[model samples]
Structure formats: structure tokens, C-alpha cells
Target: MVVAVIADIVGSRRLRDRAAAQRMFDETIARVQREHPLADQPLQPTVGDEQQGVYSTLDDALAGVLLLQLALPEGIEFRYGLGIGEIRAIESAHRELTDGPGWWAAREAIETVHARQERAVPTARSWIVAAPGQDEGMESRVSTSNAYLLARDAIVVRMTERERRLAYGRIGGLSQSALAEQEGITQPAVSKALRSSGAAALLDGLALMTGERS
Candidate 1:
């Protein structure tokens, strides 16, 4: 099975410089993909305010989305939804269209999260849903993942921009000293930012998602 992801830019219409914001968003996604090549198909704009991508696994989608969240500059963000299932393409004379349960689930998941954010949990930016017809373990997996995402989004929303930059660098395997130099701050300051902003916890969570730990 593959993981399909759909993302929508948040508040793009309200931005004064939509073109510049789009360029920045594209550049950041490119840089993150270079550092962590987890996507089967890199995210590409599909329509207004939306993008689509595929990953070989759910963990890749989760980690990839997190990288994107932390990498984005201040005042720009994307809400992400991931679905796991088989994907089939319908090729027409003009272009190929994706149609399958996976895409459907992704649509459903995105709608669910959008409604959720509007009502509450405004920081919640990512969610995953598995297409039905899986094994008995699907329910547990989905629930556990959603719970983790809720906490993850909350922590990320509370982080400062500098804290996010540090987190992104650390994910790319940069040392705290290295990040300090890049940010023009001392090592202790970088350490304090990571710890205080909950970036250290987010890093640990990402590591766990990627199976970097047993």
C-alpha cells in the first residue's frame, strides 16, 4: 500500500504577496525533500490552494509532513491529510487523474481536519486515515496515530520561528553547535530554544516515527 497526501495552503488568499509566499513554499519543500527523500512522488501543486504527493509508507508521510511544518517560514503553513491504500490512475488524452479509495480517504481526512480546526484545535495541521478493508489492527493504528498527531500539532503551533528553524536543522542531522553558528547564536542559546520550544520532544517523536529508536 502507498500513502497519499493532500495539502492546502492556509490563508493564502489573505496574504498580500501570494506569489512570493508560493515561491517560498515551493523552495522550502524542495530543500526538505533533498534532506529527507521519503516521498515516492514529491508534492506538486494540483489546483488552487492545494497540492498532492505520495509516499511509500505511512511513516514517511508523517515524518515528511512534520519536516514541512517546521521548515515553513513564519506566516505560512499548510494543512496536511494522509491516507493509506492502493492508488489507481485514470489516464485521459490530456492528463492522468488519480482515482481510488486512497484518494477518497485522503479527501475525507482533509475535510475532517479542516472542520476540526475551524471548531477547535486550530494548530492541528496533519492527520491520517486508512482506507477500510484492512486487517483487524487498522483501528488501533489509526487511533494511536491520530492521538499522536493531536499532541504533535499542539506543540508545533506553540514553537517560535527560531525554534522551528533549529528543529529543522537538527532533523537534517546538523549539530546544535552548527545550528548555533547558522543562527548566529551560542550553543547554549540554541539548546535552550530547542528545549523550551518543545523541539527536542518533536525530534524524539520524529525519530520514533522513523524507527531510529527501538
Candidate 2:
């Protein structure tokens, strides 16, 4: 199967330090490269806040994305897009290939997440499949994609509730003690959650849901 992957930092601007951000990016790249099969995958830098690469199978592509997500520094998360299709080599000698339906599908998957991210919908993820002729492998990919979406939504929902509490605190101008008492949580927990980058990811997810620019 033809698979492509895209991964990026969640809230880079708030990082405040370009050097540190670059280090994170570099480390993230190294971590991804260490993953099997994708160790040699060609990584192409994309404009703005993302990077892309291609894989020959869904297993490798998905594993690579998940690894990047887990390896990211605190407050960072990843969204991935995978497409399966035919890859036709233009010139075997040069090893160049032209875009096909698989490529289009992968781009669509990333665009789907990009559009969602603009709405500030935190922790959103999606998968798209493109096999004109259904086969057992294609069927399996579809099933796995559905499962991934469901689990991703569950995580996003939980994060949303936490962010709502934090937003309420900020909006109401509540002191740490007051907010803690109101939420029945410790003052330190309240401060920690609000200050964490995960909350920023929630805002990014919100941007995705609301159609705001990321």
C-alpha cells in the first residue's frame, strides 16, 4: 500500500523561543527516523508548521506517526493522514514517481485535519482510504481508521472539558483558591492545567472546529 505521513508541533508560537522549538523539531525528526521502516523515509519540510514523508505500508506509516506524537515534548501532539494506492514509477533509473489517487487521498486527510485544527478542536484526528477495488487489506485499513477516529474523539472530548473549566476561570477572573473550590480540585492542579500546553492544543482543536486560522 502507498502511505504518506504528516506531523507537526501543536502550538509553536507560544513556545516563545525559536532555538528551543528548532531543537524540539530536530529531536522529533530524529525520533521518527529511529522508528523501523521509516528510518530511511524521505522527510520533506512543509511550509508553516508541518513536515511530510512517504511509507510503503499502513503499518509503518501509522507506527511512525504515533511514535512522533509520543516523543514530542510536553504540550505537543500530532495528527496523521494515510492513503493507500498505486505508485507508478516514472523512470526506474531516476526513481521518480508521479502523484496518483493515493497521493490525493493522503493530502485530503491532512487537509481535513488542517481545517479541523483551524477551528480549535483539540486532539482531532482523521483517516481516509482510497482503494477503487476493495480487498481484505483495504477493508482492514478502513476498520482501523474508524477505530482510530473514535478513540481520538474520546481523548479530544475529555481535553475539551478540562479546557472549559480553565476558560471559565480566566473569564470569571477567579483566584486559584476560588477556582479550585468551585471545581472541587486543588489550586495547584488548576494552575497546572491552565498553564500547560495541552490547553493550547485544546484551543487549536477549537480553532479546527470553529474554522479559525491556526
Candidate 3:
């Protein structure tokens, strides 16, 4: 069986002070536990800013990732590194994977995100999967640049943003109102346009134009 490791931050330090950050972390931990009660997994606190988790399947890991991403409290975001490998159970709920190329690939994935984050890519929300010595597609749900771009389009449609001067802003342009006015339409029409396949196609095109895939 394949094991997946996930690591990510729990809250917003830049936007919150020590007290608020602690509260956010506690709340995030509680939320993750509540969401994965049946996983028999512990969401381990990492360093002072992040959390770590392990799962036995791609579905579990991916579900947990999507949940954490969507359920994250305001001002909080996450980055993830998922690696698949062999494991020896330490207990019914815990185990340790043999680490090597598999582990390194996972680290590289995270490092790639880190580098992109440093360059301010898509607000640094990223995920990676690795299964060394096996088929590459066995690890990542998004196995190609096209797949990744499609996922990005989905995210663009899913999230409502107010921040400007970001890639997302550039993708759809200033705001719904601005786009509406520029197109000589109502705000609701602009929203409808954003919800249409046209917006998705536009995002895909922008992704290609901007070289968003990695």
C-alpha cells in the first residue's frame, strides 16, 4: 500500500498577532480533527506555523487537502507536499515510511512551491505528489501541465477575490464591476460571465499566455 505525507501551515501569521495566531491554530487543529475523525490520524503541529498529516490513500490525502483548503479560516492558506512510499505501521494509527528518492521528490515538490511563492505565484497555494520508482501519474492527481491549468481554472471560478494587483486580478481583470462596466453590462451579467465556460477558457488562455503551469 502507498502512504502519503502532507505538510502545511495552519493560519495567518502576517495578518494576525501571536494571540490571534494561536487561536487560529487551535481552531484549525480542531477543524481538521473534526473533519477527519474516522481517519484515526493525528494532525501534528509542526514548528510554530504548520501542521503535518499522513494517510494511506490518494483519496484520503486529496480529500483532506481540499477540505483544509476550502475550510481554512479567513486569512489562512496552505501549501502541501504529498509523497507516496512503503510504510511500516508503528501503531494502528501511525507509521513511518522508508525515506529516499521518494522523500526527496516530495521535498523537491515543496521546494518548487517555495520558490514560486518567493516569486509570488498564485499567492503560493500549491500541492505536489511523488512516487519514485513507480509510474509518475500514480502520485499526482494533476499529472500534466494541462491538468494543472484546468485545476487552476476551477479554483479561479470557485474563489471570490477582492485583492487587486495579483495574478488572479490579471486573469479576470480588476473587478466584477470593472469588467461589467468595460463590457457595458450589469454587475450580475459580469458575474454570470465569470461563471460561464468563457471565463474558464479565458483562464486557460491566460495560463498559457503567462506560463502558469509547472
TM-scores, each model vs. reference: 0.95, 0.56, 0.56
Highest lDDT: give the candidate number.
1
Predictions ranked by TM-score, top down? 1, 2, 3
Candidate 3 residue-wise lDDT at 198:
43
Report lDDT (CA) for all predictions. 0.87, 0.58, 0.51
Task: Supply the global lDDT for candidate 1.
Answer: 0.87
Model 2 over residues 56-154: C-alpha lDDT tens digits? 766555545544444455555556666667645465665454566666677777777767757765446656566466598678756766465545444
User: Residue 12 of candidate 2: its Cα lDDT?
Assistant: 64
The CA lDDT at 37 in model 1 is: 88
lDDT of 3 by residue, 126-202 (tens): 55556556665663444653245336534643454331112233342367677666657787766665555344454
Please give the lDDT score at residue 85 for candidate 3: 60
Per-residue C-alpha lDDT of model 1 across residues 15-69, encoded as one tens digit per residue: 9997898888889889889988889888888888898999998778888999899
Please state the error at residue 180 of candidate 1 in Å: 0.7
